[model samples]
Target: MDPPTRSWSIYNRTEITQRYEILERIGSGAYSDVYRARRLSDDLIIALKEIHDYQSAFREIEALEILQKSPNIIVLHEYFWREEEDAVLVLEFLKTDLASVIREAKRNWENGISVGEIKWWMIQILHGLDACHRNSIVHRDLKPANLLISSDVVLKLADFGQSRILLEPGFVTGDEHTHPHEQNTPSQTWMLQQPETIPESDNSNQEQITMSKEEYFKELDDLKAKDSVDETDKETNFNDGDTSCLATYTTSDMEDNPFKSSYSYEAESEGDRSGALTSCVGTRWFRAPELLYGSMDYGQDIDLWSLGCIFAELLSLKPLFPGTSDIDQISRIISTLGNLTEEAWPGCSKLPDYGKISFGKIENPLGLEAYLPNRSSDEIHLVRRLVCYDPASRATAMELLHDKYLNVNPLPVPVNELRVPSTNNGQDESSPGQWRDYKDMDSDSDFEEFGTVDASTTGTGFSIHL
Candidate 1:
């Protein structure tokens, strides 16, 4: 457990105060670098991630802290800002990830992954999502690369940079996680260089009216002033007009309660905590429609959408919607599910990102069924329902687990049975109880400290353990 030595300075602006005995570079990324460090305290190996962007690192730390109690989440043991060095994250490591498996499957066969493996993988992902939802955390970024598989096939959700712990708004602390591929790719380039662009509407009628920059600013200022006045009036007349507020403007107005006064202070505080919770989660592709459409408030159902996508990827061996851009992704969804109708667009005009696409000219309207030709009819139905563009209509994580599609298929093996045994491979055994076993190498103590346990070690030659 000595710190790594500096053969060469890492140029990402992260100063190395004390040399960590420079083990091989485990992984690198656009914004940060990861190294396996041996803690001097107990010689306990831990994953050390050096992050350059202060805001994003903070977001990630917050997420890990919020869910540290959950076994399914990668543990963030310690974090500290070093005045002379880069911000550091100390984490528990796992063996493999779902992304590596999919890549391997694709590498072996151009046709991609088998249907059976995909089903097996999805069930595990659902289990992980269920855990996150119960804890009231949203993994805003859910993709193959972020999911780490242990040697035991115990999948631990990693990378919380974009995740948020759905607590009260004002109390929020900035902490976010970054994608692994983004970190490991070449320095000069990135997988996602820019936020995906929202495409212009092909339909002229739906285009936003062209406003000069000055006019746009003027209109924004006017709206801000109007909103301020409206808030002031509402505050002044709260007692008299609480019930008269418009439905669109209404939030749970349960600040006053007689029952709370009857309880002890601790009980009352607990009740208050239960009453105040609301948030959204999932990546753009996996984002529930309600969040993207700008619903004022949302909840964990957004994460369910991501579960559906994970289910699909584990089954299909590719991203369900590999959208080139936001516009393209939306079109792919609309093309699969048919377009939004007037019934679906109650106040679409007010949405900032809403614009027209050729829903009217759709070549096929059967939606998900058209794309999932290989799937059983029931499975296709489940995906469609879970990934519904409307957040309200999307299925909850618990509901999805109980869906007939999951239950009807050859059900998953008990997590223990399917899990790669530690004895089966020696790599994970080095850490004993600390790491999960994937069918990978026999000796991996070197990488254990960095939160990466190579599950592809079973001499299986690059397998997806999850």
Candidate 2:
């Protein structure tokens, strides 16, 4: 069969080299490399992400295109794609991520992260996730490293390579394999613009501390309403000429990389692509119980479990469950939350590998309080809302936004007040290690290899594909 054909050549390496000056390599993984670059026309810095895997590139482009309008989500200025060439995405540059902030707090702060700062970070994260969830997009990989912080102190959700779109019930498509950018026009340029600053709260309202919880919630409601109106006005005032679908070029070739040898650009039928949706995808430490049981069907709730783990880390300055392997991860979870049973999750026993894996019963569990000894009851309750065994019981991002803890006194601080850590030219050097991508396997037999390999040997986090 002839290989699938691209509709048009968006942009090539020559155009990219002429338009942007490549600064330095900021991050790299098995499937992609991110570089800090400056757009020549306006001297604005941006991130150029070159993805080697076709599937990953397509997924990230589709997800970012749908979410580019959201202030809390990373902006995708444009992308370049061509047959037999790696897809390069032009994205907003962020100096650091939440992982860096947590690390700095642990090292520099004697008392740890302030309550107001924690609330601010949590709010921004929820806003980003709410945008994704509202669009029916599930960010299967939601971790600190993926939540990037800009120089303006604004937090945006980055790294949508592992994202998936869930069709509404009864919805169907005529061409399931169609590429998202196939119908777009040939390359055009997007004018560079300075990053907008997040509005700061007025200090004149210091007396807000004396207000009741009900009044405080009302004040926040009004603030959000005003912000929504302001966003609408900005959208209305935007110039059409400033935004266009454009592409950048890169000269690097991946043909010699051993990891690039297995990738295929062939288009698969809808039936063949069905398995891709259910594949095991996520960092092991923050993965949900259903995923660990080899369940083929899961949803956005899996991200909530990861959020819980991240929030716990923020509070304590360490991972909530730092399991060395998949088995260890499960054991740690059970030891904290008790044995998995029908009582906690009615349909859990029906999971694909439920019968294959077993653990000794734990009459009593350690609970979240034991690990979070210094946190308040309210803070502990917030984590419990998301870390539960049942996916259905997990709190939605919108619901969490209105939680009493965020609305009460000592509310989230302004964006400028956030203590953002310095980074080496937009690169996060404090990351524990790079994320290793495993080759995709269609058989259930490969599940045994999950997290079995020592992370130290690979110098990467425990990640697998099944």
Candidate 3:
């Protein structure tokens, strides 16, 4: 038996000191230290990440290579295995992260981020996810901190250390994993560059303010139809892992209509993709139900789930599902999203951990309006679709941009108007913290370093390994 080979060549610490100068330490985690450094060759300011010698250190290199040309993803320049203790990755440096700007606004003397500004950030985040998924990559960890913002307020996807590139049989790491598509398409460019106009709401007061119960269900059915994965969308072949084999999800797998129960596949078809590279990878609060159910063969829908959770958090300044433990998390999700009945999740009983424990069948309202009282109809509708329980049905990033929720009255605030930490001179700081932010977020940070930890905690950590 042999140990898995890691990426990068050993860089002699003393000889290469002149090439890059470390300016200051920006952040330090249990596994690595992030530094702001200047590349002397051209005086390029790059973020140099030095991680302790471990298989996890090179995850970023693999992810970046696959996503190298994506405008929304952070660019990877140079990488080297430094000594035996670390591997260094040279990456594009951004001014700040969305988490910092969103969470620390009050400390910086700014009002809460306007819904419009949140909308803009949401668009960028989705674009980044689209880039990752287009190449069959899944960013298991998508918390606000991992979403970096440029000086001009452009959001760049960062920290691919926990990312997984979907494979043919199973997942492979390091150089063994060849990328599906390394190039971005002209269509993707056109989609990204499209003028982001916040359209006028087509729904009038009569339409927006009131809807017959029959009309409401009718609209939901219509929305579900719009979200369906049509024949045109399954063009990307997943064999080389370039989006072709989207058959990873069957016709039923992607049947995301809430009116219909969307589970119980008759065994995975040849097109079924089990993305079970690892469970328990995302920040707990934003984790999706499939991950909680221990779905090994999962897909890009998980990222969409987290994106929706982040969207809800931005609006309310509170986590939508702040579950402290796996059981508690499941409970919290059901309490709000309603019971995860076998009817809704067809294969709910088939999951590995499905019968391990039992959860009470507590029923609740399915109306997003009830949860997001002050939010617009479009926002609620979008959230409900994005956070849908059926992975087959979760809204893809591309579908989100055209969602009506974003085009409603009092549209998203523009990028220039976004408040910079040092520049929020006269604004009131109190409003930012007014949202139902958790008083105990410090406690949740305890799980930050447990990204790939073994699922030995039984229920403490929802990490499921087969």
Candidate 4:
């Protein structure tokens, strides 16, 4: 037999390029462990992710190619393979995740959900997802764990391992076709080879074949234009920090094709969509309905569903759907939203996994007011729309970002407030520029703190050793 796969522990120290120091292990995942590191060049904070598999390393690189440009997405500084160990990816470090926030919220209170906090968090995540979808990149896996918040309060969407570029039609999917590096050449064995079965017809919202490519492209273009308008403010970076210079970061440094090709997913069994690349989202708890049934071709809408679930979990401190199995997951959703009727089941028939399933007849309609108490009926109405079981009916990121509930009292955690400059040697490094400090601000504090800090101390902040 071949040698056993080598195991690397997160606690153990791992050397990097004989320069950067691995401060400590911050987090761990199935394929890699994330560590908080200090770059020796400037002693700045950074994250080092070590991936054991060579193939996974390439896939991460491919995903980053399209996703790295957006400010909402986490920044990837560098990536390299070590001759002695495995592949290493350098990233901007983050302190807390949305999952942590949800847990914290649960421990602090013994009552109903915090409507204000929930609304703000939901809007922030939607903004990020909106940016991702606008760029033709889909963060197929968007759960609380993947949303990172730095100590400075910068919210970034992390873990693009399952992300992919939604390809233009008539284009075949492959490793080389998708990745800009051209590391892997085209091979028939690698082509996306889904079964040639006709999709079941849905009388309702089945694939509207008449929707032309031009129309789709136009919609995508409009979305991008809207994001450009949003970014013109030059202040919001989804982080809770304030800085003189904008927090400039990139998700990938793909010098080649930005919008490369489509991803190639291998199949799990026969007759199923083989080679239909899946960004197989986590478990039923975090999965969108479309993902639970197994869709070969899906988009960023899956991320939106996860965002809604995470928002609910933050308020409830429990997963919105804690189903033991896929069927159970569907049951919980149908129970909450009521069984899919012909009105909302337009494209359901076309879905490969939409076979006969047992769902109890609807009795009581799920009232958002009961689930998410104290919120206005209007806001609750919006939340219901967001968490709908039907993917088509679910709120798009753009729509949610501009929702009325977000516009009302307790505005989003201002990006400027999130950036707290580090106090090195008892002096602020980012001072001398009239920057606002967020030292004593509470979780419920709003934009009123933007100009509250003493100007002299923080405005003078700027001490980069580099």
Which one wins on lDDT?
A: 2
* lDDT per residue (tens digit) for residues 419-443 in model 4: 2223111112344111112212112
RMSD of 1: 22.1
How many pairs collide in each candidate, listed in order? 44, 1, 19, 27
Q: What is candidate 4's local distance difference test score?
A: 0.50
* Superposition error at 313 for model 1 (Å): 1.9
TM-score of 3: 0.65
Q: lDDT scores for all predictions? A: 0.46, 0.63, 0.55, 0.50
lDDT of 1 by residue, 1-466 (tens): 3334654233242333242333433544334556655556466555666665433354566556555555566766665453333456666555456655654554455656554455566666776676666555676666665666665676667766545446432232223331111111111111111111222223222223344434533443443332212332321221111111011111211122100001011112111322322122234445445544444355666666776676666555555654433344455566666665546545544543344222344555666655566777777777766776565677766676677766764666555544232221111223322112221111111222224322343331222111
The regions of model 4 sitting more than 4 angstroms off are: 1-15, 82-85, 109-116, 168-275, 367-369, 413-466
lDDT of 3 by residue, 1-466 (tens): 1211443222335333557776655544434555666788899877767664233343565567666656778766765542233556667676656655655553543546677777888888887888887767888767665677666777778766556667531223323233343221111010111111212232221112234434433443343233223323322211000000111112231121111111111112211223225554565667788877776768778889989888886775556776555555665676677767677777777876676645445545444565567876677888888887778788888788788776675676776787644311221335434322332222222344324433444453343331
Candidates sorted by TM-score, best first: 2, 3, 4, 1
lDDT of 2 by residue, 1-466 (tens): 2211532222336657787777755554455666777889899898877776545565677677656657888888767765456678888877767866876777678988899999999999998998887777888777776787777887888777767767531222323322221112111232221122211243231111334334533443443333212332322221111011111112121211111112122222111333335435666667788877767588889999999998998898877876545566677798899888999998998987676666666777899998899899999999999999999999999899998999998988887778877652221235323211121211123325444432222232232211
Best by TM-score: 2
Model 4, backbone clash pairs (residues 3+ apart or across chains), number: 27
